[model samples]
Target chain A: GAGVSQSPSNKVTEKGKDVELRCDPISGHTALYWYRQRLGQGLEFLIYFQGNSAPDKSGLPSDRFSAERTGESVSTLTIQRTQQEDSAVYLCASSLTGAAANNQPQHFGDGTRLSIL
Target chain B: LAKTTQPISMDSYEGQEVNITCSHNNIATNDYITWYQQFPSQGPRFIIQGYKTKVTNEVASLFIPADRKSSTLSLPRVSLSDTAVYYCLVGVGLNDYKLSFGAGTTVTVRA
Candidate 1:
């Protein structure tokens, strides 16, 4: 792909229902990140992956939130038993290399607008 | 990551230059200053990054002082399309690169 890609641009579900958000990084990009932006709030980092290394999950809000990536291709973020507070834009970004963060500019997708009813 | 502070919003006119300054009092020596611009319903895009002094690109310029405590993002010849929220970020490293965005400075470029 020319840039990072995310699936299901918009997802609306009832409370307690689980949802899966997918992300496809740019070709050969070694770093992928997931973030969320709640209404009227700043972006909150969820997690990050550098190649095949164990992802950094310190930013995950709760045990209900988990993510995984295979090699360096695609990533998935799953929210179990979603809550009303989970409503926000789920953003995915990828960089050329995660080894040097400042040198690599992340390219973001359009993001999935998750609405919990 | 170093904490950053910026104005809530600002208004500018077309053909004028717009400058948004961000302050990071606890910036570390290894940290680099970076700026991003985001439009409504879209994700943020990198504008520029600088370690010290000045760095310029086709999109914008980042000016950092000797103290490295603050930096400014200068947008030249602004237009209506330049209206967006600008974010200033620091502490971009390989080990801990999680970016924490502030309220951001909303620049409204009017015709």
Candidate 2:
């Protein structure tokens, strides 16, 4: 089966600019998540979307970071007024279902490496 | 979410088995243990997951004792390609779906 797909494998932008990263979850996957990984650091959870439920934005570092998922298809993580600290690989993942209790492992996309100057 | 602890790194040779253990002393009854592998410039890939006892897949094996405070991921006869970062995560079914990943153990396989 095809895996989750992320666009703009690499993106370099100036500070204060806005950047949008895209993710295409696997077919039939009802849950999607976004994460950030700084160099030499573990992944930091960003946001999650489960079916029709309200997206979990608790992990968003600041108001500048936001994500939206349309139905169950695609998700876009937008960083407004990007800062140097926002430079990192943005990863997206999806599972067959949400609620984690079911033990469905998330499948991940390679991710988008964002660089801010 | 339960916090997990794992080694910083491990060194091994091709054909040798590698075992990375993770500790989650505060694991909840509903929490499950899962492992992920990531290569350079790639996203983490699920290796194996288990709630208790032992679970084995074509890629790796997960061993959890009755206490469930800790779990071990065993990769049998690893090859050079097995060199990657192995993350041990505990905390599923919380409906949060946000996995708290600590610095994973970097396994370097040398021929």
**Candidate 1 per-residue lDDT over residues A34-89, each given as its tens digit:** 99988777778889888855457888999999999996788999999999999999
Query: What tens-digit string does per-residue lDDT give for candidate 2 at A1-117?
Result: 599999999999999999999999999999888999999887898888887454577889999988888877888999999999999999999999886545888889999999999
The fnat of each candidate, in order, is: 0.59, 0.71
All DockQ scores: 0.56, 0.64
lDDT of 2 at B56: 96
Candidate 2 residue spans exceeding 4 A from truth: A100-102
- TM-score of the first chain of model 1: 0.94
lDDT for predicted candidate 2 compared with the true structure: 0.89
Best by lDDT: 2
Candidate 1, residue B67: CA error in Å?
2.6
The segments of candidate 1 whose C-alpha lies over 4 angstroms from its true place after superposition are A99-102
Error of 2 at A15 (Å): 2.2
